[model samples]
Target: MKKIEFYKYHGLGNDFLIIDLMKKRPAVPDYNKLAEKICNRSFGVGADGILVLTKSRRADCCIDLFNSDGSWAEKSGNGLRIVAAYFHSNYARKKKLAFEINDEIADAEIIKSGSKGFSIKVSLGKPDFETKRVPMKSNGKFHINAPIEIEKTKFPVTVLSVGNPHTVLFVDRFDFDWKELGKIIEHSKYFPHRTNVEFVNIVSRSKVVLNDWERGAGATGSSGTGAAAAVVAGVVNGYINRKVEVVFPAGSLYIDWSEKDDNIYLTGPVAFICKGEYLFDAE
Candidate 1:
């Protein structure tokens, strides 16, 4: 296998492989095997997920992402920014393109430099609060301040789905074992699909500090969906006004969680780490 050009990027700390699959599809015999192989820092491409950039008819461009666990997702917020940077440098051609993502559409523009990273704004579709849509085993309205047990710790959580399943817990301060708890809650029985857990500390009406125990990836990760869920949870708890700023260890994400609209939007920066190529045929 030859060294295929690749870019390493991260949203907060959730890393990814931004591939330019624009011209022709790369030969991938087994996605599951490839995900485990390419995403490994020691043995593979080294990333939390793999994001492929392709042509789109409906939007600026398109992105298809896959988790290291071999799960293909509809969208990835952090990845959007990273992809935008790649498009600007290589694919953009100094012209904007409509970004079509996973059957959804969003506008991405070439960001002028000021910050270390460029930003991307993604339309997060409609925020669904129905328990069935959230995939929570509840009826009628969504679950807010709902009690869920993971291990011996109990935290009343808001069951919300942001294109993905999540359970948000509001806290006055941050504490408790995150490494142990995050993994435990991710596999908690209630979520069915297993969920991303957010323990939030309300900074103000419009700001929050979020620590996520993300599913599929792990503790040291950034979940754009988890941040959106925190905002939705904050609104339900009367802790947030409309918009939300979720502070992570790496940085923060600004989320628009307004009550007037049913959709949520997440704005963040993606950092380009490095570009590398891998020889896979030998493995």
Candidate 2:
């Protein structure tokens, strides 16, 4: 077994175990097994997921992200920022990181956030709300005010995709039992690939509070997709203006719902918790 060094970081409160896998495209043949081992809090190194950094001929560097379930995130806002700081503070001495995520090239910057955490802002492309493009069960590109059943509970949901799938539902309050409702909605047949579920409470015309039950990550801190979903739900329901503030377990983020483009932009803070390494083996 090879000793792979790593670091643990958090954006808002979404944490990850990042690794400097070093140059060249690794055959990751068993990345799923690696994710399960390192992300395990009991018998493993412990983390939300693992990030592999490698030299990218397509871009500056490649950040391969995984969920605790060993599933790929496709793109991660927090992961991007963490990498931004990693590249800026450390790799900056030699080169600037112009990385590629989701096949899109984006230049990143590392921001100062006092002692709390390091803030990184990324041009997270655009938020897609179309029902079909967002891959929801709909005839068009948007899934707003759609009816679906979850554990015998009927409700309307809005679909949003920030490189991943999300479903938003407005609730009167944030006092529901997640243990009872989380898994139900996450696995509901209404969402084919399962989904990240959000319960939102609009506090003002521009601000709202929310709770989420993420599919692969389960219930935890903030989710970039969940925040984007809130903006989509707000615009369709006319609860608030297009741009809004969403408060989740991972602090707060500014999300803008562009009426002209129908894309949502999410902005927030990230952090570098710590760094470490471990031995990894699939068999």
Candidate 3:
């Protein structure tokens, strides 16, 4: 039996099982299969996804993110904050840290840490609005407020990439059947790589409420990138300001799309759930 130790953490109810590959490296050849097995809610440890933290040659460490269904993700905002909290509590002990995900590098700063939980601010890279960069099948134009039909209902959406593809729609209220819409749009042919979907309702120029359906994780309580993408979309469409407070089902996150650098900064709270070891046979 292979025994792998893990820690569980959550940022505004978006939970992840973090495995330190630098500590006790597993011999599994396929990490996708491993992620599927370990992220199973009933058969294994329940989590929205798994984050593999490993040593990096270019930065302080590296983050390998996998969805519950074992799909590889390019980046995860909340996952990075959780990893920063972990490093701050265990190894780094510093407020600022840098992490590499694939070829991209991001920085995180721990604002506060205590026995209760941790507050972290992560600098997500610039938002991409190009059609090709978002990987959306388009006519080479930015997809702001573009109409897409689902089940005979037309919805105007703004598509962008915040290190990941997102489809943002401004809604009047949260009473609509967003889950069904999210399911259909997430797998739409327009998005070749699929997309995380967000329905936003603007409360003011500096506040909005969001409902998120993550690409591979279904309808999650909150999504860091989803919030960032929603705010960026709002700013582009003249609905909200550059800085806004995004309210999710479980909690709220502060997002700032800086005019100076154009980088999106996300600040939220992270909770330490628990730590344990999982014993399983290698396939």
- Worst 10-residue lDDT window, candidate 2: 88-97
lDDT of 1 at 89: 64
Alpha-carbon lDDT, every model: 0.74, 0.72, 0.91
Model 3 Cα lDDT, one tens digit per residue, 194-275 = 9999999999999999999998889887899999999999999999999999999898999999999999999999999999
TM-score of 1: 0.89
Model 3, position 77, has a per-residue lDDT of 91
How would you encode candidate 1's per-residue C-alpha lDDT over 1-283 as one tens digit per residue? 6445678878889888877777867786655556667887787778888877777766656787777776776666666766777777665455344577767775555444344876766556666778887777765477788777666767788887777788887777766676677788778777677777788898889788888876667765577877888888888778787687889998888888655766777788767789877666635
Q: Which stretches of candidate 1 lie over 4 Å from their true place?
A: 1-3, 93-97, 109-111, 259-261, 281-283
For model 1, which pairs clash? 38-45, 59-98, 59-99, 60-97, 60-98, 60-99, 61-98, 61-99, 61-100, 87-92
Candidate 3: segments with Cα more than 4 A from true spot: none
When summed lDDT is taken over every stretch of 10 residues in candidate 1, the lowest stretch is: 106-115
- What's each prediction's TM-score? 0.89, 0.87, 0.97
